[model samples]
Target: MFTRIRMVVLATNAEGSPDLFLTTVDATGTQYEHGRHYDMALPRARDEGYETPMIAFDQYDAAARMLRRAATFIEGGDAATGN
Candidate 1:
């Protein structure tokens, strides 16, 4: 029993150099590094139901950025922090 998974990495380039590396794990337990993209197959359960095999790098980046911004707001003189 095996499953297919995809990993998408997003990073910023500085002076032709790569900066910041983030890794994400899909349902198949495959790890992907930032600025690098790859796919692999994972072990799956025989009794598992239908599963969609896909990964959206843009979406993940957007969500991560949003969360970071939110955290900054909360930590930086924001009412939510109750500071």
Candidate 2:
């Protein structure tokens, strides 16, 4: 429970039938980072020496989203410019 929460994944206890609450499953030790902070900082991140966030390999969707945010920052899109 100490680890950062990326997904609120849960499994119902139909087989064992735990009362009051469902069980938690830790399938992968490799956790995915949610980059909202990085997204918000995108406008000035590069200027301040903050590189674009990195998602894990084969995670094309997350990678694409990060790229799009960087692109927006570069293009002067909706992201607020200036420090």
Candidate 3:
């Protein structure tokens, strides 16, 4: 399954698209911005692949959604773990 490493929701554009930045699960702390002219960060799983990439929604729910989804990929050793 695809796992996210570092993902950040920057801002929601005037056109209503949410601005997102993220890096592959194999890598961490390195964030990439996602926009129309750029390719979104690819999701990756150690020793696995083919999982659907993360989807971005409106700004109203982006933060909550990201946090929930991101929690799934976090491991005990992950630096961002709020322990």
Candidate 4:
């Protein structure tokens, strides 16, 4: 399985609040690879029972910018230790 820090935004709903539905992304490799991981995650979620709206990190968005920075940190660390 992939590992990464995920940011989830929860909103209140009539169904007892704290609805457990959110998207995820892998915090490894370049931003492009991160996106690839996201792409696979979406369909997997639908298969497992996720009907809520999800947010994707696009190329020119702040989320993508943040992922890029994270990618730099992760990639830089990997290179240093010969991963």
Task: Name the regions of candidate 1 deviating beyond 4 angstroms.
Answer: 1-60, 77-83
Sort the candidates on TM-score, descending order.
Answer: 4, 1, 2, 3
Q: For model 2, how does the per-residue alpha-carbon lDDT over 35-69 read when each residue is reduced to its tens digit?
A: 33233223332333333342222223454455457
Please provide TM-scores, in order, for all candidate models, with all chains considered together: 0.24, 0.23, 0.21, 0.31
lDDT of 4 by residue, 1-83 (tens): 45553543323334544333345655556644546655645564455455446443434457655655666667775533343
Please report the TM-score between candidate 3 and the true structure. 0.21
Question: Per the 3 Å backbone cut-off, how many clashing residue pairs does candidate 4 have?
Answer: 0
Poorest 10 consecutive residues by lDDT, candidate 4: 5-14
Full candidate order by lDDT, most accurate first: 4, 3, 1, 2
**lDDT by residue for model 3 (1-83), tens:** 33344433344334455544433332222332333211343322211232333353322345655565566547544435444
Residue pairs with backbone atoms closer than 3 Å in model 2 (clashes): none
- Model 2 earns a TM-score of 0.23
Best by lDDT: 4
Cα RMSD to native, each candidate? 13.3, 18.1, 13.0, 11.3
**Per-model lDDT:** 0.37, 0.33, 0.38, 0.49
Model 3: ten consecutive residues of lowest lDDT:
41-50
Error of 2 at 20 (Å): 49
| Candidate 4: regions farther than 4 A off | 1-31, 56-83
Model 1: per-residue Cα lDDT over 5-77, one tens digit each = 3323333333334333333334322333433223321112111221233233423456555545666786785
